[model samples]
Target: MFTIHAVDGYIETLYLAVYEDRVLLIDSGCRSDVPRIEEVMKRRLNRPMSQIALAVASHTHPDHAGGAPTLRKRHAIPVAAPKDINQWYAGFSGGLQHKIDIMLGHFVAWTLKYPFEMIYYKKHLLYDHPLKEGDRLPGFEDWQVIETPGHTSHDVVLYHAETQTLYAADVILKVGSGYRPPFPVSMKKEMRESIEKLRHLDVKHLLMAHGGPQQVTDFPAIVDAMLKEIDKGLPPGLKRFRKLERFSPVMKRYYRERRQAKKAS
Candidate 1:
């Protein structure tokens, strides 16, 4: 009766809320995969392309917010996202970049800086409406928007109080991964804290962007495993030519590209 498909290589989630004659497509599969996204929408909705109701983005990341403009233009659907990051989408500010750097760890940031810029400039486009925490979207049965940071400053999770269904973007993923290490600004701490907050919430289904949805009955055990692994790691060892290799070549390339791009711009 309902459908959720992973879009492209983003590990992004696009939800289809089907109700009789109408449907709502959430998060338009990043800019690179618009065609595929549209096809998926058509196939799942089983209706004229024009009937798609609204497109909602969780935040400003290109992977999440990239396809909004295309979906809006082609389908004429209204688009909305967290209000705070809309400015970043417009390129007037560097808030999103700053936050990404903080959460992904500086070393990882150094590696991803360029790719992120390219992705941002190439994929990110604007939408007209503004979304904020607590705003209830049309069609959903009173889902409360909750502001969830640590993963991304503008991240927002949607909670259906009654169903206790939580659509946690990247902030909470069952994939059991850490914030791309060298440790992004001590995100280890933030992640732990965030998970703690979620533990107290009454969530029956934990739906993350990448992995499949998890049944709530396993919440405690799953949370414990994540926390355990999050704390486990080999002792610091190894050095590169008498000095530890703190960053990778990929990261160097990322930094170079971002810098060159910045200079050109």
Candidate 2:
């Protein structure tokens, strides 16, 4: 049996996938989340911290990777990240809005998790393993890494063929009554292409970083709807407003659902 734990953080969710005696942690939240992560591992999985054989950061965003260094140091786990994660960590080489969004994201994370340990806020983490397209992640049979860049230049999604599950980090998000990227998309084109790629996969369940698992009865339909929204692109101001309006409440519900889903699963 495979068990998944979703832990809510300041603005993101951390996922723990336990299969047999191995545990794979996906996306360490803010620095403040380490203690809770360790607790969950011990209490829920009945495993020591050292059993977290692998840790992966879906992207280089602070909400996703801020706690990686601390987790790595504390448990001596190898971190697998995109090869270009360092460049995105430094700062996305996009337009002015993209740069502004990156800065704003950092500010918000720091503000929400103030007095956090400074070591967790490092701009870049030293990845022990660098992943590329088509590579099978070690210790995960039938789980292939898919490079789904767009939300960030180094965003990746993991596809477990055996379970038909897609660990979609931030490539797709579920908002109120609809789905869209959260905010400040750097490359709309690449994002659309990534979604197209997912459309071809045999995905039955979507385990998103920002929401609970969704049964994909009609994934193509979902992708079509999302693409239609992408086709009618919203202006930057409107996009930001919509995102802000949905951020807190929607994420709160997602956190709750994530906990419930983990228990039920």
| Candidate maximizing lDDT | 2
Query: Which residue runs of candidate 2 sit more than 4 Å off their true CA positions?
Result: 91-103, 106-120, 235-265
lDDT per residue, candidate 2, 1-265, as tens digits? 5777787666667788887888888777766678888888888778899888888877766667767888888889888888877765343222232334445656656867754443236666788888889988777656799998656667888988878888888877787667776454545777789889989888898887766678888888878987887777874656654443222222335448768999999
Q: Candidate 2 versus the native: TM-score?
A: 0.79
User: Which 10 consecutive residues of model 1 have the lowest summed lDDT?
Assistant: 237-246
**Local distance difference test scores for all models:** 0.56, 0.73
Tell me how candidate 2 scores on lDDT: 0.73
Return the lDDT, model 1, position 150.
42
State the lDDT at 115 in candidate 2.
43
> Best candidate, TM-score-wise?
2
TM-score of 1: 0.65
How would you encode candidate 1's per-residue C-alpha lDDT over 1-265 as one tens digit per residue? Answer: 4444444433356665555666666665556556666676567545676666767788656556766777777778777677766433233234445344333333333453534322333324466666675688765545667776544445666776676777776665543443211122123555666556666678787766655466677555656665664576322531221122113232334458768999999
